[model samples]
Target: MALAGVRVVELAGLAPVPFCGMILADFGAKVIRVDRTKVTMAMDTQARGKRSLALNLKTPEGVSVLRKLCVQSDVVLEPYRKGVMEKLGLGPEELLKENPRLIYARLTGYGQSGSYAAAAGHDINYLAMSGLLSMLGRRGEKPYAPLNLVADFAGGGLTCALGVVMALLERSQSGRGQVIDTSMVEGAAYVGSFMWKSRSIGMWNNPRGENMLDSGAPFYDTYQTSDRKYMAVGAIEPQFYSQLLHGLGLDDADLPSQMSFSDWPKLRQVFTDCFATKTQAEWRAVFDGTDACVTPVLSLEEVSSHPHNQQRESFLQDSQGEESPRPAPVLSRTPAQPCQGRDPFIGEHTRAVLEEYGYQPQDIDRMLSTGVLECNAAKARL
Candidate 1:
């Protein structure tokens, strides 16, 4: 309940914007998702703990309603390309003029003022352009995408949320709000700072996958077991490496020096052969409670039932009976509550929200009848 009094108006879009709103809502912020009247409401996991208001922004009445919401809200999160909001007369300049303490956060692939600002791109494209993609795959293989986690959610949503919180903190002193331009490409590069800085330290001079943490070291890679499942190894320090060798039933005197680059492939093969002697479960039992830094690579279906995950209650079933991850980075004082209901249908709370914003029942009826607003019951099914 850290953000108990915070109000966030989230313009519904794809992953990034919804993700930002989800984090806010998780921490007790009231998040209202503004969706287009014509769009169908997909069951987006990010829509948990949020209400929906469906309006046609193309209509002047709809724009007026949004402006009124901004006048009383603390933050507005948008993921449109540059100039889209300006065309609708809801740009930062106009909105901030109405409410000086409003935080206008813009999340996009590029930035608000870049050559690629208006170009359409997804997570893969942003990662490719950020130079982070070049350092991803094996030395000679094509770089494997990390599946939208890096750019779309981590870079875009998480970064924007952090910026919004920081701006809010600063506003406490300045008593003014400013526009936040968050570019996923720039955010992606920022998150890969260690990779970029490592080059000057000579630790990252080699090609991708030829470095210590990139699966170059024999002690820091995955090996296949007899049953074809894999175990991840991260015996980085000398003590952990020693534990790993002990668990593998190998004598130190018989093996090559641990840090010898020339011996990596041979040692990796040794590990591969040794792991192939048992199934993943067998090896898991072997190193069950030791600090050997080895663990089975679990499949998605196997995760919820895993002992550690079950002990920690890392995943929980939502009100709709779907398994979803719990809110993370646990807080001692203000722990987040589990979300309690299904995601709102499009315009499910449109009437209620309009009433809260001071619109009379007659006004709501006129707007609904004029094609300026919509509700789930009025929309045609696909």
Candidate 2:
């Protein structure tokens, strides 16, 4: 694997941090999550393929142990509010000094140095602040948040992972690592570059749901079928649009011009009525191998059974029957794999990790006894 032998010390946090670590781990990096001894397990699905080391960083012994691990690790991922790590004396300045080649990454909603850096915010707030949220939804409806995928996972986690890989590539040439400051707000805006550029090209001046790709055209929207299930249509090109009309049993001579904005409402109604005449499955069969660019809008439960998804193994089920998406962007020679192990309980590998970091068995025992470290006895028994 591309990231084999790379060691990552991940400070446990929420979605973005664990997601970044997961991407690295999927590619064969050794990821050790530094969890808090007193905290409960986070609701982060990205925790798979990682080992946990629970320690109380408030204690000097815990801090000392983390510093030692950072010294031997290639990357240190921190996702705290700005200045929190600095207050804890574990900021980039301190950790990078111990390992000059360590990539110290910080992920946050705002950024390290911004007016709203210290303010509390979530994925929606970040997307709104980035102006991307204002462009979503129908014309008369309020802009809808596209779940948490945009800012949290895509902008924050995926962007940070890319930064880590780029930094590592640079490190091979410079033999030195650097800091990566990632803000979800900025990253969200960056990923929406096409939307911003469209405005300048006169292709995006209309309000939400009134633009070419924003469901303004009848050919690029979803229609309800007779069974109430939906079918998504993206027959944008002239040839594809002809295919869509042919499948709908309509001819160009019987309809208004395709590019006539004033005719969209009528065209949409015609398309909607035609789609409502058939069940989604019926429409799917009609467009299955055609260039109509029509597909069913599948529910979460239906996705795993889809023929294409099953053939590609896009989602993998674990031994416990819990399903999760597999690593993507398939590499021909060194494809990434799903995490082989289940998510670790808190402090499951504390003793082993400490010993690997050169701490004596006696020292680890003392730390555990003194409340500086913790180990999950149940996991240890296993």
Candidate 3:
């Protein structure tokens, strides 16, 4: 309920911007996603708790409707490359002139003014440009794209959401709005700040996969169990390492020094052979309540039943019976809630939203009839 009464106009986009808008919605903002007319909808986790208003932005009337929404919204999260919104006459300058208190947040791959500002890009492209891509993956393998989590969600979405909250807090004092130019490349670099800063002091002086945290150390990586399942291990400190050794029934005298990089291959083989003797469940039982910092590597299907995740109610099922992660960083007094039933279909609230904005029913009907707006009439596919 922190963002209760806050209205956000989210121009429907791909992963990052929608994720940022979802964060705002999770914290009680009234988020209206301006979706393209006839967009295909599937099981949308990011669309949770958002109202959809499908509009043909190619039309002048549709653009005017969007402008009206922006003029009345507290925040506008746009996900286009530079000048895309300006071409539609809904740029920050135009809208902020009409509404000085609007927080105009732009989520893009490159930025508004950089040389690559208008280049086509996805999460992988952004990560490569951000300089974090070179530091990921195994020792000698080509850098593995980590499923887009680094740039798309953590860096771009989470970073923009944090910026939006900070801007809202500042707006309470300044009584004015400002533009937030959030570039995914820059945001990814900022999120990987520790990796960048630590290298200066030799924390990451080694090659990409040779660092302690990046599976360089035998104790800080995953091991395959007898059942072909995996267990994640992070026994870095001496005490934890001792526990890990004990859990594996290995004597300290038989192993090399914990931090001896030269002996990691041998240590890792010893660990691999030890772990292969037991199933993941057996290993989990060995280290469950200990300080070994060992845990099973849960698959998506297994996450809902995991004890810690279940204890915290970290995931909840939607109307589709698909379990997805819940709103995070729980607040005591005003905790977030799951979507009551289902996310809106494209343009599910098109007419209702127009009426709420004081548009006449006749006008809305005319817009719908003229292809300026759209409402959900077809049955949703699952």
Query: Best-fitting candidate, measured by lDDT?
Result: 3
Per-candidate Cα lDDT values, in order, are: 0.90, 0.90, 0.91
TM-score against truth, every candidate: 0.96, 0.97, 0.97
Error of 2 at 158 (Å): 0.1
Worst 10 residues of 2 by lDDT: 38-47
Clashes of each: 0, 0, 0
Give the Å error, residue 120, model 1. 1.0
Off by over 4 Å in 2: 380-382
Expressed as tens digits, the lDDT of each residue in 101-152 for candidate 2 is 9999899999999799998899999999999999989868999999998999
RMSD of each: 2.0, 1.3, 1.6
| Predicted structure 3: lDDT | 0.91
Clashes of 2: 0
Please write out the lDDT profile of model 1 over residues 27-109, one tens digit for every residue.
88899999888776554568989988898998898999998988799999999999999998999999999899999999999
Between candidates 2 and 3, the one scoring higher on lDDT is 3
| Residue 249 displacement in candidate 3 (angstroms) | 0.5
> Clashing residue pairs in candidate 3, if any?
none
